[model samples]
Target: MRELSVGEAARRAGVAVSALHFYERKGLIQSLRTSGNQRRYASDVLRRIAVIRVAQRVGIPLEAVRRAFSTLPDERTPSREEWAKMSAAWQDELEDRINQLMNLKEKLTECIGCGCLSLTACALANPGDALAADGGGPRRWTPG
Candidate 1:
């Protein structure tokens, strides 16, 4: 079987070599090593890289990608059925995120209308300041 060098794989994958290294480190992709300790990747890795890039573009997390890839064999590209299954799993999360963004966009006008950024009155932005009770760290807003 033919194998590609790190540069060749990166070029074919349309990503930087550093990104490939990072993916390998993150367990999203794998590579073999030559006797000279040079990285070599199977042709199938190109397809895997394309999938990873698309997933990331659509806001899928690396952990999610890793989980999806864990179900596939390392020696081959993911089949259509595998891709469909992974995409279906991600669709729910993507829909939720879309809803959250829409909600936030709608609330943005209200927030601007009320100049006072008080948590008490700005229930749309921060309901009861519940995040404050968590501690003195950055508080993330969860979509209701």
Candidate 2:
């Protein structure tokens, strides 16, 4: 079983060495240590990195990626069925995010014409001063 050094893995994964370290710390990827304490990763890590990159590109958080990766067996790369199942689980969440972004775009377009940055006047955002009840911090624009 051949393994790649951290630098080689970073090059092949198209990520910085620090990013790989971060992923390791977050448990999204794993590596083995040599007798001299150098990090070496199995070639399967390239596939894992690719999956992580795709999930991140779609705005999935590292925590979510970690959770999804946890579903795979520790000793092997995810099989096609595992990948499909994970993707299916994320589909609804991604769709919800898309809808939220679309709604935000529409509101921003309306705000441009309305000029209602003033919370008191921005009925679209402030909406009957409901946020005032929440205290001093900025209110979240998106509902959970």
Candidate 3:
């Protein structure tokens, strides 16, 4: 039942203190307050931080990561089974993404031989024509 001070956790987690604070606010991690109102976290938080970093590297959005973690217990440390389940789900997603990328690569290779590399005709190079009617691209939701 060891606990780490904020500085120690950030140093060990290889993340900035502010980032750690943001994670806590995002419900990705939790902490306890000391008498002086400073933050302290259980050693198990190191594992949570690692998972968050890996999830981000895999292109999983923060909101999705938060939702995935919601299925896990917060009070107790996660067991290997718990991690395995999450990893299994993520693996499926990665496989699907790989398939999509491979399909796109095949299409582009075919286009190369078809002399359709021109931006006006190339779906791979300029998707703007198809995407222009899709509400002007992805929306960036910012809090007002």
Candidate 4:
């Protein structure tokens, strides 16, 4: 089997070297270590990286990708049937997200129309005023 050095793999995969390291750390990909302690990747890693990139572009979380990958064998590129099953699962999740976003978009207009705090329909309702239970101050800003 053909093998690629870390730098070469990163270049061919169109990702930073650090990103490859991160993926390996996350158990999303694996590498072989040489006697000199250098990382080497199978040529098939290029295809795996492509799948990861496509999944991220479609809003699939890394954890979900990891889970799906767990269902697949690591010996070779996923077979057509394997890909079909994985894609179908991702498709279903994407459909649910699209519906949720559409519903939110519709509600956003309504929310903008009225800033009333009384209506449960208020966009920032916080459902059951849950945020208030935590504290009265500003909540932490979570970065993407």
Tell me the tens digit of each residue's lDDT in model 3 across 1-144: 778998999999999999999999999999989999989898878988888887777667777888888888998878889988987887876785577557667767867979887777776666555433334545531212
Select the stronger candidate by lDDT from 2 and 3: 3
Candidate 4 lDDT, 1-144, residue by residue in tens: 678999999999999999999999987888989999999898767867888897787666677788778898887667878878877877876675577557666666666766555565575565434333323435431213
Query: Residue 40, candidate 3: how far off, in angstroms?
Result: 1.7
Error of 3 at 13 (Å): 2.1
- Clash pairs for candidate 3: none
* lDDT score for residue 41 of model 1: 88
Q: Write the per-residue lDDT of candidate 1 for residues 1-144, one digit (tens) a residue.
A: 699999999988889999999999999998889999999888778878887887776666777788788898776666888767876766776676577567656666667887746756774556434423334334432322
User: On residues 20-99, what C-alpha lDDT tens digit does candidate 2 reach at each position?
Assistant: 99999999899989999999898879978987887766667788788778888888766888878877766766676577
Question: Where does the lowest 10-residue lDDT sum fall in candidate 4?
Answer: 134-143
- Report the poorest 10 consecutive residues by lDDT, candidate 2: 135-144
Which numbered prediction scores highest in lDDT against the true structure? Answer: 3
- Model 1 / residue 62 / CA error / Å: 2.5
Considering TM-score, which of the candidate structures 3 and 4 is the better prediction for this target?
Answer: 3
Better of 1 and 3 by TM-score: 3
Assess the local accuracy of residue 87 in candidate 3 as a C-alpha lDDT between 0 and 100.
79
Measured with C-alpha atoms, the lDDT of residue 95 in candidate 3 is 81
User: TM per model?
Assistant: 0.67, 0.68, 0.75, 0.67
**Candidate 4: global Cα-lDDT?**
0.75
